[model samples]
Target chain A: MIDLSQTISSNTIVYTLDMVGVAACTIAATILAKRLQFDVLGAFFVSFLGSVGGGTLRDLLLNRHPIFWLHDLNYIHFIIGLSLIVQIFYHYVERLDKALRWFDALGLAAFTVIGVESALSRNMSAPIVMLMGVFTAIIGGVFRDIVCRQIPLVLQKEIYITASLVGSVYYLLLLQTGINEWLRSISTLLLIFSVRMLAVYRGWNLPDITLQPKEKQK
Target chain B: MIDLSQTISSNTIVYTLDMVGVAACTIAATILAKRLQFDVLGAFFVSFLGSVGGGTLRDLLLNRHPIFWLHDLNYIHFIIGLSLIVQIFYHYVERLDKALRWFDALGLAAFTVIGVESALSRNMSAPIVMLMGVFTAIIGGVFRDIVCRQIPLVLQKEIYITASLVGSVYYLLLLQTGINEWLRSISTLLLIFSVRMLAVYRGWNLPDITLQPKEKQK
Candidate 1:
């Protein structure tokens, strides 16, 4: 296993940007919890779960110890601080409806890049790395939606996992090019964010499975 | 960080019983997928996930490498073999309506004991060990329900996690008595299975959260 603390601490830009994504996700969870009329404790739990659920799954699957949040107390404090802020500004946030979409897209993109980098550093296969990237970007939302009793948007929404997969592919290609790491990271993040935003704006979606009458007979 | 291979290979009965639990969960997933009208790939994925999801989480949290299923190829083969059998006997299994509950409870009990033993061997704190035991028992079903878009029964239905928790507590207490290992294991397993079966039969449930008028104001 890579020394995650050393690697993450050394990459100041990526680390900072990744925390921004975590914050975005936590805020989104808080908003969802508010809409669902959850109490303060419930809201905090949802926010914390959404922020770290995917990474927790990833770290667990990868057999990494202490988990990311447990390794660094900063993540927990950041989530708690943001959850409190969301509660305080609840009314203001309710008025800014589009904020959820934007923040969600940003977090999706940022986490995809981070996921790709983490998996790539482990020298996993391309397909596995891409899957891990998409998993990191979407699994948190999946867990949050499930707890909220909604079908996970990632499984049903317009062009969600596709954007993450594309971004991961781009990052892997960038790695082969041996370019500046910072530039590659930024490019991958922007690419996913743009794709996700464009998809939401234009209502792009991967084709859903449609049952064919003739094929069903077989 | 326990030598899972040595432990599992050494215990013939627990190993066999654990596989039965895995098989039961996979069968349950297959039945669920059929109800949801999933394709072959989706059904296989769900079955595989449901069978291993909880144990995967436990192993991950415990920082165990290669994961349990990955460490042993037999698990993969068993799930695949059982899945195929379910596909062939789908209608027969459907006719056996009460089979789901019985199989699920049995699996839950078996997995709980296995989880407790795994954690106990590592000398973890008692509370953590009990939590892990309950977690291993319930997490698979939670994942299965989430993917199938149903509210997880563990979160809503009868005295499920409570039974697992009680059983684990019993196992922990049994450790203090210095009894035979097999006797301790069997007692824990029987205690959980009987509690779950009795609860389902008696229509017992944990009290759900309900807001009172006075509490709401506070």
Candidate 2:
């Protein structure tokens, strides 16, 4: 006899949200592949890597078996389907570069919250958890950009990583206040998304940390 | 009282080999960072990634906790020390590019065997094990190259990926034959190293598989 009244757990919800982030990031990778004029296989490879890279690292660090994607085919299907759709509609995607940034920001936020919660669940220290959150939020895109031979936006003169760091730390602080779990997660997501979007809008960026003299600057 | 005579297993040997590989790859990464003219911090970051990226991914996929490096500070110390040495001897390294390739090949071989054995211990399928081995063999360099904004040599015209796949598959076949374990492992290491070196000497490479027409190819 199956228990019919069991509520879905927060872990499950976070997993679902992470998948959504993966899907969005996969789409972004596909678009980047198109821009790079990669072949179909290269495009698919980059998309898959972008979708799963961060979460895979998280699961590995946490010692989760089979990895998230390996346990189910849905993530793979989503990535492939989304990649194909993007390939067919790349012209439209070019016009929606702004929307792409928003989608990526949404993924970043969702991933950050999910990463934070997962690390917290594992009883990792707060700073480590927060950094894991930031790593999760940014590494997938970093992988994609690197594979495509572009400087990762996270390492560029941008506020992307800073936004993730702040959001994750904020979420951890909220957790200590005994707030409603769902509310706290939602707030974290919003905080990251909003900060990233504002950074994009306001052209916010960290000063260059290059060690070379002015003539050697790129 | 702790038992004094329980001999260190093959696992320990492979792990030590993997660490040696890590050190070699770290030096390679530091050299690459220098050629890229990264700052000191950037050089260290790249070196650390090259040292641990492959093993980290393998551990993650196999659900190993705390990761190998996290469990021991020695890996961290080795990376830092190697990075400093390479930084101080950057000019000497420039004159020894040939030696760098040899060290890299040795790392590739050792990492491949370790990765293969780890996956096999987890009862992964043969194909998956081989692929994981290849991933472990090449991914660190792939990462270092990608982060430095160079095309990953694995995906470039190099014969790198082929050698890994061959070495791993060969090692697995040897295991199935119930051969002496140390002999099997050492042979696999030698095979990969030899293949890679020969490919370099012979100027062997896979043909480009660009999907674009001649005029559009890069």
Candidate 3:
């Protein structure tokens, strides 16, 4: 397994962006937990799961040790502090739904890029890398929805995973062009963020697959 | 990290029991998929998740490499073969629900023991070991339920996780007695199986926690 500590510590920009993603995910989850009438403990639990579930799964799949959150205590401290703040100012937080969605889109883009980078560093296959990217971008929300007993929005005709996949593929192709690394990463992030935001704005959805014909056609 | 390959390979009984547990989980998940009106591919997917989800999470959290299923291809082959067989004989398989529940209980017991043993081999702390045992035994079913868009039974006040936790603690205590390994394992397995079966038969449930009073709620 690749040692990620040095890589994670050396990249200040990536580290900062990753924490922003974590904060966004935690806030979104806390809002959902409130909607579900969960207690503070439940909200905190869901927020933690939402913030770290994806990266944790990715790290585990790649056989990385200590897990990211466990390796860095700041992740836990940040999540707890943010969750408590959200809980304290829930009335104000609830009104930030629209803003939260945009933040979540930003998070999704950042997470996808980070996941792709992590997989590429390990020299994983293209398909695996792309999969890790999508997993990192969306699995946290899936986990939060599951615990809240709701069908995950991404699994329910949303274009969310598609955005992550597109960005990951775009990033991979850009690598071949020998472009500036910073520009490549930023462009991929913007592409994903734009796709996700436009999908939400246009109310775009993937066509649903009907398992059986409704009541036998005449 | 402890190399479990040799330990898993040398223990014929444990290996056989683990496969049996996998088969049982797959069959149960297949039955659930049929109820959910999922297609063949969906059923196969759910079965795979149900059979391996818990163990995968346990291995990942413990930083075990290669993952148990990837380490042994028989797990994949067995799950596919069993799932296909169940799908082919859906009508007949549907009648075996009662039998399947018993098999699942047995599987839960076996998986808990296996997880505890794996953690113990690594010298994990007691709480972590016990938590790993429960995660190995139930997370698969949790994943299956989540994918199917249902509230997981274990999270809905069921005694399922309790049985696994009890069995794990029992196994840990049994080690203190310096008993024969086989006897210790078998007794722990029986304890868990009996607890689960009895809970099902008696309709035992954990008490629900209400956040607020109904009249003053919201």
Candidate 4:
């Protein structure tokens, strides 16, 4: 009997994690778009764009070849598939705000860990990596809100990007202390998820700073 | 009197054109944002973003040092100045929609030429240069439209990016034929502006291709 051996690349694992996170974001974004009375095309735009927009920005900045979906065509197909499901049962998703919130937090946490680790692997400096991680984790939601004609929660000083930033720092500290890789990843995810959830539940928001109206705001 | 002599940088003309193109885009975006009823903050965001966002994206892709604004802080002040002036005279701007449309067309034309030229200078393939031109010219407007909660004209068949693409082709052909550099640039801009104005006046639009309501759209 002949046996075939296969090894999964760490990149593959990271890619899969990103896909899962994006799927969760897509579902949440579709629900939000519907609640806002976005048309069908608007819902699809919100979902797909909010899901992949950040990673696309990251890839463009890095000059990476074949953007994530362009590479794994399946990822695009997956989003399309998920969008259809949401479209079919729009009422059901609208009624599950609590579930969607939990899923969003989870997805945000997962993407934070994944983005920070990916940047680290590419040898980006800590500050840059942290920014990229946080941006990757939450810029999608910001973009969605912007397109929905609303102020982005991130800009308004919610504890959004801060949670991702803190989680990334924790991951780096663990790496410095020689913690097991698996443990560090889990810890980072938990750290981000808990901080974000607690912030939402406890009404903990970042202090909003005025930009001084340097240009004579009207 | 102290001598104020300075050595002219070899690439002064090239860099000057690039900045000029960016400034034009900034002014046009500010006008559009105003017409759309964006407050001072929103207008500033759209103006500054349209001006710097394209070059920033290009520099990031090339991993160049000192993003354009970082190297020359004047742009920050320039945008502030423009925003202040516009806000104070908001009434005048609102009365100049016809002039603003022409400025918008000019900005689009200028950015299209600059984008393709820069990519070509960097030794990118023609197709890549073409794509860059289209992206640089249209992305800012698309972003502005999206943020205003309006469907982006380019994403539809607005004949926007297509005009830029055609202009890029004309510029490349002019270069291939060894036409005068000034003529090449002017013709390219003229071609695009004329085409865009004609399209807008005639209500010309690209036919919308259905992605089909099947389980696939991403």
Candidate 5:
């Protein structure tokens, strides 16, 4: 049986490591997205967004002080490490983009769950929790997209944010049933990933509500 | 003498118009920066950051409610206007790049003074207000540079942040002396613009903290 205190300690360790993973994954995603034209500095910005943007937004919303970063400089080291990794592994990502797609989905799923759970622990309202979940899922990518000068995926005509919303709500509902923590974590991750993957595969999109152009032009 | 309330109102109008000017300047900035082959979506992203990123970050730190755009949809309209202006009047900016450079400096000066006023109005400490002033002045350009795949102006050994810091401190010093708002604003703006322009012309940069390799790589 895993002791609860040990579980908490282990989770913290894993989270910090996973943050580094986010940085690395962000670099891979941007490199692939931009087709190798993104330079070292661009890769660094993407990695920073991938690793830190989501958590930073979460902390800001929760009114947490010092941020996860302003206190410990480990994240800075992680970003540097990830940037070097990209410099070394550029060819590998270019040659194998498909596998990285799946990797990106898994990363997104894991991050969504973590964000939603963090909000719930702070006793946020359900809507706020869901918003937090969506914010967490997209902010890193959104920041990356902004820095990359691309339309944010959330604003794109796709089911991206919707999939995140569905998964967040499902996870919260399951929690009400007294599910085991580990199982809940795994299952929610699976749910978010599958839903998102399916949505992407299907080209699902929300209804467009574009404002019609006013007359008076030629 | 100007009525105090009318003066405040006029400043607010100027503040709002400056926001629009910032937006227009951003879109124009990106179109020029990416005159080479580029992703158009990324261009809009750069415009968005250059227009709103600084103020948004300021609000986030200040713990204000309903971020500026969320409160009034005018910012959204401003963005649309920028996009349209770029699509139509881009050639003009290209023709005037040399002259427009000074306009960019003016925008920076105006933004730094306005940023200091905003922070001080929120009752932030002088140091924190100065920091906010510097942040607002540089973040937009820093963001634009990163997305354009270049080192940020401040990070590139430029005098960008230095100008903002000087201007902000000067603004505070003026306030301490009971200087009238209009004169104080003009002096601060001139100080920031002159310092920044002089540094750019002179190629001034703080020394880079270089570290020699302890061991040579083969």
Candidate 6:
């Protein structure tokens, strides 16, 4: 089998993966909207937020101009088209929770790497770059959940952010070892995707920390 | 009484008003945190989000660099110091809900004007500028409420966003009349403050639109 990563430039691979990630996020959000019984407009809005909100925030934080969606109308067009299609097929699409998790995992992996690359291009330090990676991977979901009036999933006792953070640190370390660019990208993406999927499959969760007050004497 | 607006440059007036707005928003958020019984760190986070979140979102949308808080460390320092003080004085401050509404109104007015001016500087169109103004006035509270896991107040039946939108349109019209800079600023400020306070005092609300399904035959 031909290795696509070996044949394609790293930028092209990343860009393609980013598009897939955006599409996956939009689909997942559309399913959520259906479950929430949001109207067509609400579904469109949530899907847009889920697909682009994180990168938009990241670009703003890094002072990147002409935000990604505005700079290329194709992303907007794609989201609008996909949201409409998903809404039209909501009866069938709403039952895809099993598939939705996989799409979300793929999005998490792709967005983490994309965020890291974006920050790296801006010459950010390692810690900030890793933070950006995690931010990019999870913030759109946070925005989606916030708009839905629920606590963000990442902020809950989920192993989601941990997977993204570990993958980011792993990618950073890989950069130092002078690995093949495509290999590094693919390997990091696989690592995040596997970790997230495994967490979901095993029902892994971060321990919830609650501070208890000292017991008063009766 | 001396007209301080007349003595100070319009830029300085806006700058000073911006600071007042920030402090007011921070204090309002701190009061909210006290009611919620959040820890000090949570209080600080909420206050920071309340004070700067709107403008930061606006600047990012307009593609302005370094973000307003990052460009001036004073905003950060001020937020931290004010949040800490408010946390310490929670016993007294929490009882100031009557006073809190006034501060919230003042912030809405100031931030609306600041957002308008920032957009005008960017040479945006009238409608977009007005939107920027409304966005800047209310997004912080939206952020704060979303974090607290509630529907944003502006999105509710409250007359809050209406006040910001009307003030923005009024300010835009004033710009056409070529009025004295201070007079324009002061008058517009008063208009928004009055509109908001009046709405609060009268317990006015926007009509909530609910689409009713056609009655089915029994």
Best by lDDT: 3
Candidate 6 lDDT over residue span B1-218, tens digit each: 97766666877888887998899899988888877889999999999999999999888798887798997999989999999999998898888879988998999999998998898888877766776787798889878987787666565445677788788898889999979877777777889999999999998875422232335222
Tally clashes: model 2.
1
Docking class of 3: incorrect
lDDT of 6 by residue, A100-144 (tens): 889889999999999999999999999999999988988998888
DockQ of each: 0.13, 0.15, 0.12, 0.07, 0.06, 0.12
Candidate with best DockQ: 2
lDDT of 5 at B214: 69
* Candidate 2 chain A worst ten-residue window by lDDT: A2-11
How well does candidate 3 match the true structure in TM-score terms? 0.60
**Cα lDDT for residue A186, candidate 3:** 84
The candidate that wins on TM-score is 1
* Backbone atom clashes (below 3 Å) for every candidate: 0, 1, 0, 0, 2, 0
Model 5's CAPRI class is incorrect
Sort order, DockQ high to low: 2, 1, 3, 6, 4, 5
lDDT of 1 by residue, B89-168 (tens): 67667767797888888899999998988888778999999989988888988888878887787877779999999999
Scanning candidate 3 chain B in windows of ten residues, the lowest lDDT window is B206-215
lDDT of 2 by residue, A14-67 (tens): 777787798789888887877766645456668888988887878777766678
lDDT of 4 by residue, A1-218 (tens): 43222123444556666877888889977777766755454565577668887877777766664455544656556776787688677766666788776788878888888778767867889987888788788888878777666677676656888888899898888878967565677778888889989998898987767676757876
Off by over 4 Å in 4: A1-8, A22-106, A118-133, A153-218, B1-53, B65-96, B123-131, B138-191, B204-218
Candidate 1 vs candidate 6, lDDT winner: 6
Give the per-residue lDDT digits (tens) of candidate 5, residues A1-218.
Answer: 86988589647744743563475456655574456476777667667776678878877756667787798787778776766676677777567667765666776777777788777877776766776776677678766666566645454455666667788888889978977776777787778788767877877665432222344222
Error of 2 at B52 (Å): 1.5
TM-scores, one per candidate: 0.61, 0.59, 0.60, 0.56, 0.54, 0.59
Off by more than 4 A, model 3: A1-48, A58-63, A69-139, A146-218, B1-10, B36-42, B211-218
Off by over 4 Å in 5: A1-139, A142-218, B1-4, B13-17, B200-218
I-RMSD for candidate 3: 5.7
Which pairs, if any, clash in model 2?
A60-B60
For model 1, the stretches where C-alpha displacement exceeds 4 angstroms are A1-10, A215-218, B1-48, B61-63, B68-139, B146-218
